[model samples]
Target: MLIGGILRDSSFFCIKMSAYPFFYPMAFPQWKEKLLYWADSRFSYFALTQGNEHSYPQNPFDSCFFAGNKELSENDLWQKRAFKVGVLGYDFKNQIEKLESNNPEFFSLPDLCFFVPELIFKIDSEGIYASSRLSAEFLSEIETQVIPETGSVTCKISPQITRESYLKSVQNIQNEISEGNTYEANFCQAYSGEFETWSPIAAFLRLNQLSRMPFAALFKAKNNWLVSASPERFLKKSGSSLIAQPIKGTIRRGETASQDSENRKKLLASEKERAENLMITDLMRNDLARVSKTGTVRVEELFGIYPFPRVLQMISTVCSELNPDTSLKEIIRATFPMGSMTGAPKISTMKIIEREESFKRGWFSGAFGWIDESGDFDFSVIIRSIIADSEAKKLYFGVGSAITIDASAAQEYEECELKAQAILELLRGN
Candidate 1:
């Protein structure tokens, strides 16, 4: 099965780069601008930001930037091709990640396995697409220019747990910490409401513009749409080296320039934030060690403070040398539903989280990214994101913070708001 835009002109370059049927079109310098087009013309669409906004010769063959629409569901048969895109729901942890989830589900994703998209478009200076045969009218419609505008779509957002309830949950987690059951746990809450006419494409565009995160992604599969501006990279594989940058600490950005600088410094100097970031970093290192060569797991960066549009985050990069024979599935099994999202003593903490949190996380904290045929992959934590169910007319976003021994429940609640600010504002047409 094939997909993509109709070739308007033979001048639009084409290259027989591989054994598979593909076409390389050399038009539209900015591939992201084509998202609305694909989302409208095809049933599946995915866009990964490569952070190449001003770079020249932007279409590198190995560049991470890619957009595509699924031709059909190959089900679990993803080994045939090097490329597949989809979400791994949180519940999948019960089977693959070796954790149990007995809590009832509030929002569930359709699939946990990789999906082979029908039409894959790799974004570069020249975009790549599968050959298609659609009507000229439809083709023209897709190619038409879109003047981006923030839609005035509003939805009533109510937290699943009230402030008092969240505080009580935090205290419960601290009790577990005090009991030595777990060192830290991530606590999250769901903010959801109905927006029957919400436009995913527009919301994603505005969200991305507001916060151009390193791992930003916009994905749509059937009725579900995910718009992410996540800065934490769950896992990335390049050749034999594996990298996971887990983010654990966050502070809201300051009001003024000096204040912002001071906030960054404060985060850098905060023992609490550093301890939180260090724990997650160590957790990731241990997770990678499972699939990595013995003595290969190492922390490359620790407590590295990075400023975002809304918050200042402390991130750490953990690196390891992968065992060549390690399969993609094994790698994911060793480390998924990323530690940053799960917390330390993974299995035990997850059990506590399930018992405490009000809603099933679903895809909110799950990983999403591409896996090439060569077994190379890069996935980002699904944080700072919005999930919209167009069919159900409901939109949901989850926000959480790491709860440690010395954590303040009130402060943690505020952190969730800071993390959610951008998407919330975009949804409110702010």
Candidate 2:
């Protein structure tokens, strides 16, 4: 199966760019390696945390750097695509830097802009700066093979822990809560495997069919990779304006309109949900404040509900006027790690995250999107994603959530499943 011109519109940047080839969530690490090997420069990749085994790494397909007025925009500029549309989002800071070094062609620009999807899905290094032919067919070589219906996975986790062990962690978290250590702490696990023929691109096509999300991405960074069908917005930019949308509250989708309405109302009223949403909003506002003009940051919309196939979410929009003096690189540096994933007191949350979690997040919770010549950039948090490193014969899906005193383990587990639904569908041979 050949999929092309899969452009991703950054709900954050309010700007549109094309997407290149896509993948299952697990292909990221290998893809990143390949991207680094052939490319001539380094770049940035952002990934996001959805909850448990679901996150992505965000990387630029085509990027040009900026140094105060050395703009990337030229009348003839456009996106580039390749045989494999390379994607990278999510973060393992050390891991990302290594990825950039490996893919010399990957770019991390400060104050520059380009179409992320176009670069990954439809454009190429030679055509990256060209004015026309940003179409997917013009860039990538997509191939598909027909295989017999194999509905079951032949493999399973190694040294598998019993349900008792998995259940033990929950009990520990409960213990922590009882001890006043933390109300809810995100936890994760990994399952790796080999695929005689598991194409992430194929998985993505099937996944997209299931979710039909308006915005999605499939990226590969050298050692880690990500494929996502995310419907969440982390941030966006236009001209000199910046905006952020943080998703917090959620309720599963209902079978009927009345049920859905009732669920939405409940999300609106839930104090735990509201508190999580509000805290992230404040964190984002503060993050934006670093690059936005003083006193220009404000909440444009609070507690807005966006319904997805599996669940309902409460998202809030915050906006700020950009600082004329702010450099593009600085803007990103200030907010590379969004507030939604880290929780309030971001640094503290991060330290806790690092200490409590078992593996490095790599690109999850990082931003992915494009930046243009006009100094306009757009990015999305990598949620609802799967990570793949085909060479390692590894496929990993994760889930996580913010914890407060009010969080319920059972409900949080359900939320984790909601986040994992799309990828799981693909895995089930949708």
Candidate 3:
């Protein structure tokens, strides 16, 4: 039998079992070639109940892991029923212009890389299920391997930009907003450091434990690793329906319950924050409209506040229905480098970003997710992430906030610091 152009015997073989404690610890260290583990924290506060919730069927495996595979190019992603997992870099937006830069490259990763896995694990409330093309005896042997104890790692990292420089950049963007050059721009800064001795698996586990974000993921390919605790979903395709959740506003969580309620109220009522979110929401709608069926583009949820462990974010959901014939490349071309990251007036803002940002973003603002055998896919925006090159013993992370006309330079700087807090604590071995 043949399925999706691959022999059925070579396709996934699945087994259902109770959740095992050693699954992550045992698997992480061995699958250094390619591994991706994604978790949806299922936090109580994230109640996204609007827009096609009942109309569209949901994907069964929201939380899953992929291991074992060879790299596939972006061109291969659109093949019929091609099941692959990968990351898309922000530099993919360079197709708009022949942009050139002299900034140093912290992690020399490709713009796009995908892989076909021989093993897959899907986790849900029901339990954990394992699927693989490998022999069952080999998997049984993996189950018997001993789990290693966690190790200590030390890191010293600093922002690549000074406070004065960051504030100056904010003022520059505000000036551009005033001049109608762009409505809003997401300006980012990079932090780079070296670690004495490190365990990539342990570091990711620790980071995931602290953040507990809804879109948490750990992906390793060769010497490059992406440990992400992102709270935003860039895009999801289910059947003919497409969804985008873009986060635009941020405020630190209050210490007390009452203070937290007050902060949420402030974020919801603030004119500036609302404007920032509205601009991006509109941009997303337009982007989807470009590739969607007529009359199917709509804003599902606007300015919905959601809470993570460290902060509260204002996220909006926009959805559309695509033609069955739409290709992955076409959808990405219409909406790559998501709106929340690029700002309003995407092309113009991207040009400004290329000029103003101190370093190349690379995969920082890109997305990571999987494409199923049925061609349905989901991806999360790459924020609140640590990108590392183990061979060089060097690590880098990025933090930024949207800048608008009414934005305060000092407050925006503080916001960036707030966003960087979790990863900073992780690096300090807290």
Estimate candidate 1's alpha-carbon lDDT, on a 0 to 1 scale.
0.72
Off by over 4 Å in 1: 1-35, 48-80, 102-104, 111-113, 122-141, 145-152
* Cα lDDT computed for each candidate against the true fold: 0.72, 0.53, 0.73
Per-residue CA lDDT of candidate 1, range 1-430, in tens? 2234443332112222342245455455444455454455555455555442422111112323333444335344345254676677667688765566665454556546354544443445465444343444544545564634544357777778899999999999999999999999998898887865777777776787888676677777767888888777788887899988888888888999999999999889999998988888888888999999999998887887776677888878888899978877788788987998889989999999988898878888998877666777767788888887878888888999999999989999888888888877877668
For residues 222-262, could you state the per-residue lDDT of candidate 3 as single tens digits? 77778788777889988889999889888889999999999
- Sorted on lDDT, best first, the list reads 3, 1, 2
* TM-scores vs. true structure, each candidate: 0.85, 0.66, 0.85
Tell me the alpha-carbon RMSD of every candidate.
5.0, 10.7, 6.9
Question: 1-430, model 2: which lDDT tens digit per residue?
Answer: 1113323233212223433223222222333223322221232332221211222112212232111111223222232221112222444333312322122111232212222322332222232332223344423322221232542333232312233444455566556557755534444433334455465545554565677443466544433456677666666776788888877888888899999999999999999899888878888899899888889999988998877667887888889999886765567666656677766566544544554445555445565555554556556676666666656656655566766656765676667667767766667654
lDDT of 3 at 194: 86
In model 2, which runs have C-alpha deviations exceeding 4 angstroms?
1-192, 220-225
lDDT of 1 at 155: 75
